[model samples]
Target: MKLLFIRVSLFGILLFNGFSLKAQQVKPDDKYNRREEMITMRDGIKLHTVIFSPKGQTEKLPFLILRTPYGVNEYPSPEKQGYVKDMADDGYIFVFQDIRGRYLSEGKYAMMRFSRDKSNAKAIDEASDTYDTIDWLLKNIPDNNGRAGMYGISYDGWTTIIAALDPHPALKAVSEQATPSDMFMNDDLHHNGAFRLSYAFEYAFMEEISKTDSLYQFGNYDTYDWYLKLGPLSNMNKKYIHGKLPSWNDFTIHPNYDAYWKKQALKSRLDYPRLAIQHVSGWWDQEDMVGPQDAYKALEKKDTKNQNFIVLGPWRHGGWAGGDGRSLGNIKFEEPTATYFRKEIQAKWFAWYLKDKGDGKFAEVISFQTGSNKWKNYSAWPPKDVATKNIYFHSNGKLSFDKPSAKEAKPFDSYVSDPAKPVPYRARPIEETYGPGSRWYTWLTDDQRFVDSRPDVLTWKTDTLTQDVTITGDVIAKLYAATTGSDADWVVKLIDVYPENYKKEPKMSGYQLMIADDVFRGRFRKSFSTPEAITPNKVEVYTIDLHAADHVFKKGHKIMVQVQSTWFPIIDRNPQKYVPNIFEAKESDYQPATQKVYHSAQFASSIELPVAE
Candidate 1:
């Protein structure tokens, strides 16, 4: 019921290279005090929250609130944020709360239910909870500044955006990071309509069952091989249920994008209200690309000029927190990318919006320009002048910006796709499981060379780069083909082929880094909402758009594009036989498929690159 306030210097603060000038040290008299409290809603449902404030004073200060489904006390708290302590010392109250149904918060867990439901679903909404929490904090706590700011990453980040929807009058600003707006299209469960089985299974386990100490240790695998070790989705279900894993039943029951995920996902009815906002994300964050982009675009669409700012770093999810800010895995970026991101971007963003200091000019699009390996601000994403180019594939392994000859299109590349031993894109052993936060979903060190060696994985490479080719924005792979079976799946990977000497360092020899890669569920190729069965032997064109990325194919580096039917155990193998929904698919539905990739003029297959002007 009590809040504390600290003293700040009245002296004018100066900015150095977009970094804050606030002293990094806490004064001897200034200390941070923490306490636990439950925020009760109008309906009387209590949501647990942990409050951190400056010690010693009985005065009130501006509040910064973060509500997350990913528990508060033991949740993956940012290890580097002594900033909370520093901010608390600087007369700011920091609050961390557990969204209902997940940790200490009391209520039946209603997954993703934030907006209005005609079904009369019982759940606590972020908007109502945020407003109620702020109202109580203002009235109960002493010394008064009624302003409140919100910020967090992933689920907590999503809540920040939800808070902006029908925003509280006292809500001043929010920083949302790696949060997804539409869970169906771009989150862990589904990507371009493709089901991410491994990622989702582990995700459900970590979120639902791992509440207890014993469960946390046994039920979840933070490392990479957990998916492969868990074997299959059916196996995961069996082990979880028999073992009495927490939330195992929930994960099993929510097979389709049904009411469960839908309730958890924010509705289009949710509009952005006028509030100071800073959207944050990573270009390489494997899980949620829609978070920052959607928030920024939604705000822009809503016509709210409430000091909207976007900071897109080169790091992965939570990468800016603990990473070196330069590289992940075998990939080594230039210098101090992560350091510059936190010290200059995140720290400064909070200082500007939450503390109400610095120039108010929020950059429309502040991002790290890859390939150039420098920072550039764009007036808009995919800068207006960016030229779109399509690279066509030829039968003889020839790829060019221009169309190929009729002779080059005579026969389609044929391959036999076996579901049992599917191709792995970014797979790795337990020893190398901890990939970059941005690419944790993507199996790292998964050398495509093996897949390239297979007849099933059609391989095509552009002739050595005559000049430096840089790509910014999303990449799309459009294929025209016919399958002998009723269904199929295609995964495209963009690889930076090393100069034969790319080898594993120190221990081994050469190592090559995978630039970016994506998978598409072919049955839902035409329409994600309404899936259709493929007409056997009837030519169909599937256009799969890969996620956005910024990379430079240096002068000598080769651009290798690999197409395969399955990326196993990461993604469940699509039964070649067409089925109603993958969740209900059976082993009897599984069949070997004869897949073809047609590249002739009549059925031209090509990849689209968002070529930067």
Candidate 2:
């Protein structure tokens, strides 16, 4: 966790971004004077902190702090070395801290430490530790303005958000980017009650196996094969981890959305501080996309002063924090979107609120609409005037706005979902998530045509659009599906099918771009906290949240939807058999089952789109 702060963030990504060939030539700046100190928390635990101010500073500057479970080295991190030169030039008392129990800090480490009970004075958590650190920084650090602003990416982003929940008087602004809100629901560990196999397992091993950073060595280059061959979830401990990783054990104990997860959820803390707030994320963020949006929506409800704001772009993880942002993988954007966010939005956001450098003006929501390659601003998310339109699935692999016809009774598409031969989420030879030459960063933008030929994966698409179809809000997938087994996992992907013979980019011709997607564990459909076996062969209504997006399917492009039972090792293969706890399921529980997607007038299956007015 501590290493992720520096390794999974700004500099780490910039180094790997082959797109930023131009950025690499520029020499890293090291003009700021750096000093390290051990700041004492309320519990007498000393936190590792580093402060950097301009070499020859005359005027006092507001402190911009980033608290991360990832270690902040004695010398400034690489991101501080180059990526934030703009902020450095603008003048800031930049401060970085390693949270308690992480590197250089004195205390036991905890993963995503939750908010503390305010009633208990000695109760220590990430929020309290941040408050105490700020309290100390104010008195100990010299040549600093009274005001402070907090911001970070990923884990640090989570810390930033928790700090704002119980903010201090001097904490004037917060920029929580890519922060996970609910671990068990739609972020990091699980998505709609389905375990994020590769990410969750690897992350727990990397963060918890030791105090410092560690990566679990895998034998196979294609991790999908490795995870599949590894067998049941129980083998994770018996074969390698052996009940050592805390989060892994937690995953087993709390298979359901139990009280344990409910208590620690930052989303439950809906009240936002009375300060300027900005929630930034990407539409294609493979992890934590729902987090920032969830937090932003919660803050919006209480934002009488219009302090809550959001920025949704076409990025992945910490992609927006650095790089040209002009493009990702094979997909290209209109301009250097990330650079614009940094120089225009992020820089100005803190400058205006902290230093009063600019007019206090910013959009309530800034969304980059894809396909059309344009940025749009709106007063409300899901844009208030948008109309809900349902596109139903047709028998001949077609997606139509009209309801299913009554001519055919019990109309449905059938397929055999074999656990032994699950459909790979992305192209094969998939490397370690963050390994060198890994496509994990840009997997979302990969062409979905790779799986179109698979027998088990059902593909349906609308005809070439006559005009632009702009969807600018939340998208829901209402599926009426039945299975021969008692339990299963449903994976839905909304796609944009490019017109063949596209002259602009021939290679991208016939490309199927995944716009929005998610997986839902059928057993937990009724209640996330409770599990109920499916009534086999009986159609069950499943409403899966495809999340929100702002995308445009241009004329000549087709809108497509793909439904499959398995997304490979990315999402653990649902056993298709009813078990008291999937984690403890025996090898016999795994089996192939028949899945049917109903498309009848009586039980119409469709994807709900919020077509912008």
> What are the per-model C-alpha RMSD values against the true structure?
7.9, 3.4
* CA lDDT of every candidate: 0.64, 0.84
lDDT of 1 by residue, 449-493 (tens): 655467788877777777888787777888888898998887777
Across residues 497-546, which tens digit of lDDT does each residue of candidate 2 receive? Answer: 88998888999999999999999999998999889999899999999999
Worst 10 residues of 1 by lDDT: 10-19
Give me candidate 2's TM-score against the actual structure.
Answer: 0.95
Candidate 1 local Cα displacement, residue 401, angstroms: 1.1
Q: Which candidate has the top score in TM-score? A: 2
Which residue runs of candidate 1 sit more than 4 Å off their true CA positions? 1-30, 56-60, 74-91, 117-123, 210-264, 304-306, 430-447, 501-512
Per-model TM-score versus the true fold? 0.84, 0.95
| Native-referenced Cα lDDT, model 2 | 0.84
TM-score of 1: 0.84
**lDDT: which candidate is best?**
2
